[model samples]
Target chain A: MIQHLIVLPVVLPLVMGVLLLLTRFGSTGLKRSASVITTLLVAVVALALLLRASNGEIAYYALGDWQPPFGIVLVVDRLSALMLMLTAVLALGSVIFACGGDDEKGSNFHGLFQFQLMGINGAFLTGDLFNLFVFFEVLLLASYALLLHGGGKSRIQSAVHYVVLNLAGSALFLIAVGVLYGATGTLNMADMAARLVELPAERDGLVTAGALLLLVVFGLKAAILPLYFWLPRAYAAAPAPVAALFAIMTKVGVYAILRVYSLIFGDNAGNLSALEQPWVWWMALGTLVAGTVGVLAARDLRLLVAYLVLVSAGTLLAGVGMGTPAATASLLYYLLHTTLVTGGLFLLADMIGQQRGKAGTRIVKGRPMTQGGALATLFFIGAAAVAGLPPLSGAIGKVLLLDAAEAGQRLWLWPILLISGLAAIIALSRAGSTLFWRSQDGDRGGAALPRPQWVGVGLLLATSPLLVALAGPVNDYTRATADQLDNPDAMVNALISGNGDTP
Target chain B: MESLYAITTGVLSACGLYLTLRGRTFPVVVGLTLLSYAVNLFLFSMGGLTTDGAVVLDGAGDYADPLPQALVLTAIVIGFAMTAFAVILAMRARGDMGNDHVDGRTREDSEESRR
Candidate 1:
C-alpha cells in the first residue's frame, strides 16, 4: 500500500495528462472536472507519501523488479516526499487560481498542466541520472507549450530566450551525465556513489569537472548568478498561473543539486577532502550577489516577485554550501517557505494586474497605498510574509538559516544575507503599501473588487501563520531529511541488500 | 591521438563561446550547436579512447565504456530536439518582434525610455 502511494503522485498526473490529450475536443466542463480530480488525487497521494516517509526512507520500486545498478529505481525518501507534497500543493493552488479567470483560451490547458506536474514529480522521485534528464525534457516540453499558451507577442519573445538558454543547459547536462556514466559505468545514483569511491585520485578531477558541468546546468535552471538573466524576463512575461508553476520548476533544479551533490559527489569520502569548503563557499557567494542585485534592480511588481525568487535561490544555495546538518535543515526550511510565498506573490500579482489593469505600476503610488479594501489587506499580508516579517513563515526559516550560517563561521555570508532581506522587504513593502493604502488613481472609478477573489488571497494569507506555528515540526522533519541526504549509505545498503539485482 | 581529440574539443568550445556571445539570435543558435558537439566529444573522451569498442555486448574482450556511448546517444537526440526548438522559437521571435537581436530593445537608450 505504501509503495503504491509512492508512485501515485507521478502516475496519476501522467495518466490524466495523456487522457486529457485524448479528450482534447471534450467540453470545457469535462476538462475542468478532470483537472480538478487529477490535482486533488495528487494532493491526497502526496500527503500519504509524506506520512509514510515520516517512518523512514522507502525504496518503493525497482524497475521490472530488477536490482541495483542494473535497473532504474524510484525511491521516496523524506526529501523527495516533501518535494512531492510541495509540487502537488502549488499545482492545486495554481489550477484553482486558473479556474477563477474569465478566459478559457484552449482545451489543452489542463492537459499540459498535468503533464508538467508529472515531469516534476518524476524528476524528484527518480534514482537514476539518465531518468532525471529524460524527466527534465518532459517538463521542459510541457513548459514550452504552457509558456506560449496565450500566444501573445511579448510572451513568445521571452519564451524564445527562455527555451534557448534552457536548451543550452540541457545539452551541458547531457554531456555531464555521459561523462559520469563512462567514468563509473553506472547510472543509478547510489551505485555511482559507491563506485566513485574506488576510482583513482586523478579520476576524481574528471568527476569534479563533470559535477561542475552538471552544477552549471542545474544553476541555470535554478536561476543562479550569471545564467539567471533569462529568468526575470521570461517569468515576468509568462501568464500568471504559468508563472506560479514555474516557481516550483526552479525548486526542482535546487532539489537535483542537493541530491546529486550531497549523495553522489559531496560524500565521495576519498578525493573530496581538499576542495569541498572553498568551492561551495564561492558558489554560494556568487548566488547571493546575483540574487540581491537582481531583486534591487526590479521596477514592476511582477518583476519584483520574479527577482525575489532569485534571492531565495541564493539563500538556499548558501545554506547548502554551509554543508552541515543544521545548515541543510535551514536550507530545507527556507525552501519550503520560499516556494509557498513566491507562488502566492505571483498569484497576487495576477489579481492586482486584473483589478488595476496595465496602469498599475508599483503597489505603492505617490503618497499612500491603493485601496481594494479587504483584498488589499490580504495582499499586504502575503507580501509581508514574503519579506520575512516576524511571526511569518519566511522569518522563521530565515532565523534557522542564519543560525546555521553563523555556527559554520561563515561570517562573510551574513552581510549579503542581510542586504538580500532588506532589499526584499523594501521591494515588497513598497508594493504592499502602494497597493493597499494609497487611494485609487483619479481616472479610475473607486469600484469595489469582488469577494471571491479576496477569498483566494485570504486563503493564502491564512497559510502564513499555520506554517509559522508548524515550524517546529517542519524543522524536525527537515533535520532528519537532511541527515539522510548527507549520508545515503544506509539507504543504499538497504536497497542493495534487498534484491541484489544489478542492472 | 587523445591529445588531438582534446585540442579539437577545445577549439570547438572556443568557437561556440564566441558565437554564443554574438548579438544576433542565429549566431547564438549555431554557437550552441557547436558547443554541444564539443561537450559531447569531451564527455566521450572521459571513458578513454578505444579503437573499435562497440556498445553491444558481444563476446567482448573490453568494451570502450559502453555506458558513456549509450548516454551520449540519448543526449544527441535530445540536443537535436532542443536546438530545433530553440531555432524555431528564434524565428518566431523574429516574426513577432520584427527584430532578430537577442534583446528586444536596441543597444542604446531603451532603459531611459522606459523610465
Candidate 2:
C-alpha cells in the first residue's frame, strides 16, 4: 500500500473531483472543503515522495504488472517528486484563494480545480509519452473551463486564442509522438532512450526530426520566444486564482524539455545533442530579452506579473541550456522560487484590483486603496522577492544560477541575467510607486479583504523566505536531481530491471 | 498509396494553416478543426499501413502497430471536444462583445469608441 503512494496524487484529486461534480447542485461549502482536503492530501503525499526521492531513489510503478517497453509506467524520481511538491503547493494556494470568492462565481469550479490538479500530477508522474499527451489534454480541458470560470468578455476573448494555440500545440504534440514512435518503436521514455542508443546510424535523421518536432511542442508550451504571444494576454485576463495556478503550467513545459532533452537526447549523443545546444541557448536568450521588454512595457499590474512569469521561464531555460549539473541544480531552485513568488503576486494583484475598484490594477493614476498600507507591504515583499532583492529565495536562486553559468564559462549568460534583473527591478518599482505611492486621494482606508484571502497571500509570500531559510537542504536536493539527470543509465537500468517484476 | 495519404495530409495542413491565420473567429475554428484532422491522419499513418496484417499479437503474420491506431482514436475524440469548446467560446464572445474578431474589437470599433 505504501508503494501505491505513487498513484495517489493523481487518483485522490480525480476521485474528489468526480465527487464534487456529483454534488455540484448543492452548496459550494462542501465542495470547497472536499477540494481543499484533496489538495492538502496530495501535498502531504507529494512531500513524502520528495523526501523518499531526495537520495536519488527511482521508483517505477507498472500498471497491471506489464513490463516496460509495452505497458504504461509511472516513475517517481527526485525531479518528478520536486515538481509534484511544487504543483501541490501552488495548487493549495490557488484553491485556497479561489475558495475565498472565485469558486462561487462559477459552476463546478471545485470539480474543475480538482481535475486540473489530477492532470498536472499525472503529467509529472507518468513514465510514458502517450500518457503524457492524455494528461496534457486533461489539464488543458480543465484549464479552458477555469480560464472562463467567472464569465467575462475579455476572458472568453483571450481564452479563444489561448485554446486555439494549445489545440495546435496538442496536434503538434501528437504528430511529434507519432513520429517518435514510428522512428523508434517505443513510447516509454526509458525504453526510447535505450533504443536510441542502439538505433542504426541510417535512421538518425528521422529520429532527430522527431526530436526537433517534440522540441517545438514543448517550446510552444513553455512560451519560449515567438510562441509566447498568447501568454501575456491570456494570463492577464484570467481570474486571479486561475492565473496563479497557471504560474506552474509554463514550468511543466520547462520540465518536459529538461526531461526529454537530458534523458532522450543528451549531449552524449554525437550529432543530435550538438545540434540542439546552440539552438537552446540562443532561443533561451531571445526569450529572456522578450520577457524583459514585456515587463517594461506592461500597462497593468497583472500584465506586469504575467510578463515576469515569462521572464522566469526564460531564466530557467537559459540555465538549463547551459547543460551543466550546477546549472540544472540552480534552475530547479529558481523554478521553486519563481513559482511561489509569481503565484503570490497574482493573488496580491487581484486583491489590489479589488481595492482600487474602477482603476482596476492599471498602472495609471488610481484611487487611494482602503488597505493601502497592508497591501502595499505585501506588494513590496512579493515584488522585491521576485525581482531578486537580497535576503530572499529569488536572490539566492539567481546567485546560484549565475555562479553555475560563470562556472560553466558561459560569458554571455550572467550579463543578460543581471541586466534583465535590473530591468525587472526598475519596471516593478515603477508599478509599485504608481499603484501605492503616487495616489493620495480622499480615501484613508479601503475595505479589508477576507481573512482567508490574506492568509492565502501571506502563506504564498512567506514560502519564498522559507526557501531561503532552508536553502542548504533544498540546494542539496536540487543538486542531487541534477546529478541524477546527468547520468540516465541509473534510471534506465532501474526501469528495465523492474520489467516483469511485481513489487 | 502512401504518397496519396502524405499529399492529402500536407494539403490539408497548408489549407488549415492558411485559414487559421484569418482574422475572423469562425475561420480560425474551422482551420483548427481541419488541422486536427490532418494531424490525426498523419498519426494514423505512422503505424506503417498494412494490407493483410493481424490486428492482434499473433507472433505469426505481419501486424501493423496498433498503438498509433489507439492514439489516433483518442486524439480524434479530443479534437472533437476541443472544436466544440472553441466554437462555443467564439459564440459566447460574439454574444458578449457583438464581434467575432479574435481580439474582440475590430479597428472600426476602436475608432468609433475613440471618436
Candidate 3:
C-alpha cells in the first residue's frame, strides 16, 4: 500500500472532483463530507510519502506501467514530498476555513477546489517538463474559476488581469519548451541533465536562452520583482479561503525553479548552473525591497498579507540563488513556515473583516465588535508570527535564514532581510493598532462568526508552535532534502536505472 | 517554406505583444490568443519541419519526432481553454464593473489617484 501511495495525492482529488461535480446540486453536508474525506486521504498519503522519502528513499511511479524517459513518470523525492505535505496541510485548513462562510459564495466550489489540488499535486509529482506545464495549466484554470467563485465586481475585475497575464506567461512557456526540445530533443528533466552534459559548446546559447525564458515564466508566477504587479491586486481581491489556498501558488513557481534548476541545470561543468544567472539575486533583492515597501504602504489587511507573500518568495529565492546547502536548507524550512503563517493570516483577516463593519479589513476606524477581544487576540498571534516576533516559528526561520545567508557571505542580504522584517513589524503594528485599538464611530457590532471558523484559524495558528517543537527533525529533513537537491546524481541515477540509493 | 513559417510566427507574436499591452481587456485576450497560435506553430516546427515523413511507428524512411506533435496538441487545447476563460472573464468584468479596463478602474480613478 505504501509503495503505491505516490499517485494517490493527485488521483484522490481528481476522483473527488468528478464526484463533487456530479453531485453539485446536492446538500452542502454531502459536499463538505466528501471534500474533507478526500482531503484527509490526500494528507495521509502525502505524509506516508514524506516518511518514505525521509529515510533516504526515492519513490518513482510510471503511469500505465511504462518505463521513464518515455512515459509520464511521477517522481517523489524528499523535496517534492515535503512540498506536497505542506500543500496538503494548507489546503485542508483552507477548506475548513472556507466552510465557515466563504463556500456559499458560488456553486461548484468544492469541485473546483479539488481540481485545483489535483493540479498542484500533479505539478509537484511529475518528472517531465511538459507534464509540469500541463499541470500548471490545470492548476491555473482551477484557480481562475475559484478566484471568481464569489462572483463579485472586484473579483471579476482582478480575474481579468490575472487571466491575461498568465495566458501570456503560458504562451512564453510553450515557446521555451519548444526551444529546449529543439535544442536538446528531450523534455524529461533528468534526461535533460544527462543530455546537457554532452551538449556541444556551440549549442550552449540556445539552451541558455531557453532556460532563462523558463526562469522569467517562473519568476512571473512566483511574483518576483517587476513581474509581480499582478499579485497584490489579485490576491487582495480574492475571497479569504481562495487567497489562503493561493498561499502555496507562488511557492509552486519557486518549487519549479528549485526542482528544474537543481536537477537539470545544477551542472557545474555544463555551464548551466543557476549561479551563472547573477540577475536572480539582484532581482530577489529588489523583490524583497518591493514587498517590504508594499507591506508598509498597504491600506488593507489582505493586501498586506499578499505583499508579505512577495517578501517570503524573495527570501526563499535569494536563498536558492545563494547556492549553498545550508542556505537551501533554511529556504526549505522558511518556505513551510511562511506558507502556513500566510494562509492563517489571510483567514484571520477575513474573520476580522466580518467583525468590523464598514471598514472591512481596511486600516481605518470602524464599528466596534462584540467579539473584539478574541478576534484581536487571534490577529495578534497571526500578525506577530508573520512579523517574525520572538518565541515563534517565524522568528526561528528568520534566524536560520540569516545564519545561512551570513555563512554564504551574502552580507548585503542581511540589511535587506532584517530591515524588511523591521518594516513588516512596523506595518503590521500600525495595521493592528488601527483595526483593533481605534474606537468605532458607532457601537453597532456585527454578528458573531461561527465556532468552526475560529477553530480553523486557530488550527493553522497552532502549527507555529508545533513546527517550533519539531524544529530539530524538520530541520534535519530539510537539510537532507537540500543536500539531495545540491547533488542530483542519485536522483538522476534512480530515474535512469531505478537502482541508485537515495541520499 | 521554413522562412515563411518563421516570418508568420514573428509577425503574429509582434501583433500579440502590441495587443497585450492595451489597457482594455478584450484586446489583451485577443493578443494572448494570437501569441498562442504563433507559439503552437513554433512548437510544431521544433521537430525539424520534416516533409513527407512518416509519423507511425516502425517507419523505415525519414520520420519527424512525434513528441513535439503530442506536446503541441496538449498546448493547443490548454491555450484554447485559457482564451475562452479570458474572454468570459472580460465579458464578466465589463458587465459587473461597467468597463473592461485591465485594472477595473476608470479614467477618473487614475487621474484622482495622480492628484
After superposition, candidate 2 runs with Cα above 4 Å error:
A23-25, A406-409, A499-502, B107-115
Question: Which is better, 1 or 2, measured by TM-score?
Answer: 2
Colliding residue pairs in candidate 3: none
Clash pairs, candidate 2, are A370-A445, A370-A446
Q: Per-residue CA lDDT of candidate 2, range A52-127, in tens?
A: 8887778878888787868888889999999999999998898899888888887888899889999999999998
Clashes of each: 12, 2, 0
Sort by TM-score, top down from the best: 3, 2, 1
Candidate 1, A1-503: lDDT as tens digits: 55466667778899888888885457877777788789989988888878978877555577676666677788888999999988887877777777765227644788899999999999999989989998999899899988887777878878877877777777788778877876677888878878877887677776777788888888788877667888887888887778888999888988988888787765654665223345556676787777777677777888888888888887887776777889888989889888877887887787777667555545445322234565566667777787788878888888888888754455777777877889878767766666655655465433444443454445555667888888888889999998888776866675656642222
After superposing candidate 3 on the true structure, give the runs of residues whose Cα lies further than 4 Å from its correct spot: A23-25, A275-277, A406-409, A441-444, A500-503, B105-115
Who is ahead in lDDT, 1 or 3?
A: 3
Off by over 4 Å in 1: A273-277, A361-371, A407-410, A440-460, A499-503, B1-14, B38-65, B105-115
Question: Which candidate has the top score in DockQ?
Answer: 3
lDDT: worst 10-residue window of model 3 chain B:
B52-61
Of 1 and 3, the candidate ahead on DockQ is: 3
TM-score of predicted structure 3, chain A: 0.97
Query: What is the fraction of true interface contacts found in candidate 1?
Result: 0.59
* lDDT of each residue in A1-503, candidate 3, tens digit only: 55568889989999889989885457998888788788888999988888888987877888887777788889999999999999899998989888886887788899999999999999999999999999999999999999998888878877887888888899888889889999888888888888888898888899988999999999989988989998998999898888999999999999998998888888643667773347677889899999999999999999999999999999988887777789889989889999998999999998989988677989888878879899889888888888888888889898998888754445778999999999999999998888888865667588989876887788888888888999999999999999999898887888887674312
